[model samples]
Target chain A: MSGAGEPEVRLLGSWASPFVLRVMVALRLKVVEYEMQQETLGNKSELLLRSNPVHKKIPVLLHNGKPISESLIIVQYIDEIWASTPAILPSDPYRRAVERFWGEYIGDKFSQVIRVLRGSVPGDKDKMAGEMFTALQYLEEAFVSCSQGKQYFGGDSISYLDIAAGSHLAWIKAVEKISGIKLLDEARFPNLFAWADRFCAHPAVVDVMPDPDKLVEFTVKHAAMCAPK
Target chain B: MSGAGEPEVRLLGSWASPFVLRVMVALRLKVVEYEMQQETLGNKSELLLRSNPVHKKIPVLLHNGKPISESLIIVQYIDEIWASTPAILPSDPYRRAVERFWGEYIGDKFSQVIRVLRGSVPGDKDKMAGEMFTALQYLEEAFVSCSQGKQYFGGDSISYLDIAAGSHLAWIKAVEKISGIKLLDEARFPNLFAWADRFCAHPAVVDVMPDPDKLVEFTVKHAAMCAPK
Candidate 1:
């Protein structure tokens, strides 16, 4: 629940969605209480449809009856609106741009390559996995630069990049389990592997993070659907 | 030629690239002075490569030697660092999210479909154009909501969405001429049609907008490269 005089907040989300998990973690980080309405897969809620007519997808963050779609945009909106302690993005413009650049890379490149590796898209699996590993190596370098040996990307605090990349940890792990592939190789990607561990263990993320076993089970069941046609 | 105490600013971009034009418009709107380094096609500069190592793409803005890549991110960084009048993004969090949503839609959906329509990628031309028109019509509705009958999506001022969408006007027009297809139909997309005209005529955009004739010629020359194999 919002504090007195605070506007109402609600999140339309699916329990197992990595995107939804991002919003949940952001909300928790901000300590902003809100209602969660679960959106069923295949049968999206009317509220979800009405809230995000364009994408018609979860998670949509509704503040005072207005909807904000897209996880990264929603997270930024939350940060700006709340404007309290524990800033999600860095205040410095350059740093913010760097974080955003990597965040986009995570969404656009890293995740897409992983989709192929996980058999969602028909492709040369080894080639796709190699691309994913290359991207991960780049992200490892990014973490080194951004963290400066700090625990998190934002240097001691979870950040936009952390949430953006960290949200996919479970899905990546599930892919590893299902495909028998080593993606986040400890020796090759020490920074990212350790960072993933720390990110999942973080207070704001732990409760909302998807269960690994459940993800593996879900991925196994959906393997046929995702298999290369 | 920044003012005293202003940081040294430079832009790495190609003259005809719509993405570069976006950053140019934003910089001009904020009245910021900067140097421009034109990058050649297929032959990128070491500065661009070093500055934006992750993507190694153009339209990189160097503010005091620190580089910011991605047109939208650079625009936001300009808006934030300058923090002057004629804001690129709305001050209200919700409005900002709205603009960001539309901006992403332009990049992710509208522009990709246009790529197909222009023969850049092999696809059903008619179907791709239909999708493009649908997206334009949706933008028309978005304009009605965001503009509130005002002249621009930002309500009387050009904004991030306007830049994101409007930057592609020349290419869209060139496609219409080259392919002999009528996109941006006045009858169907009245709001966007009118908005495009207004947007193109704006002082900040007019000077930097690509020449339609040049674009058509370029398209004709490159048509062979883009033809479906």
Candidate 2:
């Protein structure tokens, strides 16, 4: 299906971008062939610039030379274009809207994770941890409602919500280990905790995830760069 | 299509919210009958709280008692469920995805408008105006590319992208009046300027838009509230 004259798939991405990993996971899940064009975040390539002029961020999915930027949008595009079995998004529009709602909720948590990491000093730990725990409670409820005892988030198969959450799972573990924030403890967020395990174990997501140690190191470095020096 | 046995549509919205007006515009465009459940944002009603616990903000669309929060999400939901005649979102998934991409871009501008408002002062006028002008230039290009000699954003009919842009048009004018930052002047942004005028002239969007004078008054009041006293 993806022979010459077919759509040429190239992923312009950086190793540090969870957004990039999301496109990778989606592509793998759909069994779409693509080349990963690595781009540094600090010094983005001219190709990356030409691909995505809007935000100029990475994880640009280049299909037949047309680039789609924004990680979530790219994931949806992949879901639509690839149109393989085990659709990540549900068929019914209402159900699709619900999955998208969860995706937006997960995206919101991404920013909160950054704030938690940045403000993870000893004095601010309790406050940040409290916020993180409250947010996790919401995610756990979302998982419980969607899963109904299933392994993944909304269904037995990894749905849109699962991928949305999966993108952040590695970061959660790395943050928990680095900041001692206890993001996804099984005792507290059992449903989500289990969901994370199932998501990461998938070959589609497993190999693409950044090493936890390297991720934490990068986070620390980013935090230092952002510090009010 | 929407009648007895169908879940009653109740909108939790504030008169001040452009986001609320967005849902209102979409619903009106679809000719769907929905009761406006006005919300006082400061002392939010329990319905608003329950419907949108995450943000606890206005513009939650309740259909048959099930709630959908987030303006754009509600817009898409409205477009989906009320698929009788005039389709706001395009049917083709690629076209729909492109519409969504622009919707996200316009939404991004909504926040930048707030930042410009908060940061605007006599000393910061040129800098703020420059940023606003640059953003408007992008919107102009988007309209030119998408319209392709059409009246509305996507076509002659009011589209999802047009609704996205229209929701903020009233506020954009009000902000310019209040801050005196010429954003969509015809010389710089002729396409966007013409588009805004057309969007406001639409019967569905016309009545629902917050009054310019009142909107400016509210915006001034809001700026005062945000100032570090």
TM-scores of the candidates are 0.93, 0.90
Ten-residue stretch with the least lDDT total in model 1 chain A: A218-227
> Which tens-of-lDDT digit does each residue in B1-229 have in candidate 2?
3567655898988887778888999999999888888876467898788888987887888888888888888888888787886888876666666678878887776656645663443345566567667777877887887778999876879988888877887777777786766677998788888888888888998788888789778766766876898
Tens-digit per-residue lDDT, A1-229, candidate 1: 5567655998999777888898999999999988898887678988898988888989899898888999999999999999998999999988999999999888777667667766667788788788888889889999999999999999999999999999988888877876778889999999889999999999999888988679877656677655579
In model 1, the runs with Cα more than 4 Å from the true position are A1-7, A224-229, B1-7, B224-229
Per-residue lDDT of candidate 2, residues A5-35 (tens digit):
6558999998877778888988998998888
DockQ value for model 1: 0.88
Candidate 2: stretches off by over 4 Å = A1-7, A115-125, A220-229, B1-7, B115-125, B220-229
- Per-residue lDDT of B1-229 in model 1, one digit per residue for the tens? 4567655999999877889999999999999988899998778999999998878888999887888999999999999999989988998898999999989887777667667766767788888788787788789899999999999999989999999999899988988886789988999888889999999999999989999889877766678664679
Question: Highest lDDT: which candidate?
Answer: 1
